[model samples]
Target chain A: MKDDLTDRILVVLSSVLMLTAVYMIFFYAPTERVMGIVQKIFYFHLPLAFMAFLSYFVAFVSGVLYLVKKDIKWDIIGSASVEIGVVFTTLVLITGSLWARPIWNTWWTWDPRLTSSLILWLIYVAYIILRMSVEQAERRATFCAVMAIVGFIDVPIVFLSARLWRTIHPVVIKSKSIDMEPAMISVLAISMAAFLLFWITLIRIRSRVDFMELRIRNLEKIKRGGME
Target chain B: MKNLTYLAAAYGIVWAGLFSYLWYILSKQNVLVGRIKALEGDD
Candidate 1:
């Protein structure tokens, strides 16, 4: 269908960008003198974290729109974003742990950034579980909208945790400077763009599936009524 | 140690995680479409 043309193009663009970013990450970006090769994980870890944050932001905006417009489509977008966000958050935690194991010599730590990120993951995960438990469509949508907006409170806390507290996590962006080489910065920018476009493609696929499911449910209900 | 193992694991997990989620979503989509077609055929 014509509706899917954008989705098809975005999928290809994102995949190509992702491959380019990966090649640059390995070959082009200079290795950190102190951390050595393990430092390469930072290229991926930061982008995954960025995408997770973007997902929650989209969810928050969709939640607000759903409340204002009283539309089911907004609910669909919010929940889809949360679902993708949770997967992204899970990866963030795993990748962080991997990086931490080698550098800090510990797999897990209760630092402010780590703790807040875990809490953020749990919040949206609970949001997904909430959707699954409720049967009444309207009530479920309302709960999802409210929860998405409220859960977004943790995102800023997660972002500022390193700065706001005495955390072991590295603060990449300080008051006036970023501490990476020019090449590293370019690779990171490309990686972020790649992931953002990929996230959009994912949203399109998820929202289409949800709309189809909703239509099927409505049709089934009507068919049952007709039979009765 | 230079931590090559950790590096590989980290990148591997990222790719695996993303691909796994994509697979799950696509599978769910396929199943739903099948149901819709079945319903339409019956009517």
Candidate 2:
């Protein structure tokens, strides 16, 4: 009953948080002068990138849990994090392209950030494909655990590769040294909050769906006399 | 012309892409929920 209630609360909270985010982005946030309307992409792009990073970090932690405890829940969490990470990363890529068209005068580029992100995306895609290839659950989970651990090594690399290479992606949005207006900073903070809420809600919903599917599969196997 | 066109393109792409993703997630959830229902019936 407690778990059911938690799920319900999460469902409601996610809806409300998303609605609020939409409202804040469209109404409260001031249009950027330099990027103009295109600047709105920053609100979503930065948040998606941050959440993608968080998702991979979650995968890394859960990967450790899987290795230590050998708990299937840990494996499930790791897999779910990877899946969500991929989705957000894809969004980041798309939004980056939109931002790039205006700022860079190109749809795509071979810049360090863009290149590294594409590499990270491919690596996780391979991990998912690897998960699907194996027949046995235990073997698949074990293999994926290893892959998840290895995959996380690339997260920091992707994040810093751009900075290290001195790529054109802005180093900081608003800084005390070269500060944006106070109002801009406040708006950015609110946007970040909204995005974080969005990420947590998405992960919770996906995790529940993952759990339910696993339960269904188990029941199916039992009904078939452990055939699968 | 170039600056104005780029701004319009950026907004268009952002909204269109997000809408597509939102649709994708909804359709996927719908499919998964159907699977859940079928499994419940089977048991």
Highest lDDT: give the candidate number.
1
- How does chain A of candidate 1 score by TM-score against the true chain A? 0.96
> Clashes in model 1: which pairs?
none
Note the chain A TM-score of all models in turn: 0.96, 0.86
Question: Residue-wise lDDT of candidate 2 within A2-54, one digit each (tens)?
Answer: 75476457656645664665577667778777777667677667777888889
- Model 1 bad stretches (over 4 Å): A3-5
Predicted candidate 1 versus true structure: per-residue lDDT over A67-113, tens digit per residue: 89989999999989999999999999999999999899999999999
The docking quality of candidate 2, as DockQ, is 0.33
CA lDDT of each prediction against the hidden true structure: 0.91, 0.74
Q: What docking grade does candidate 2 earn? A: acceptable
Q: Give candidate 2 misplaced runs (Cα > 4 Å).
A: A1-33, A173-179, A226-228, B1-43
| Residue B8 in candidate 1, Cα distance off native in Å | 0.7
Q: Mind giving the per-residue lDDT tens digits that candidate 1 earns over B1-43?
A: 5599999999889988887887788788889889999988888
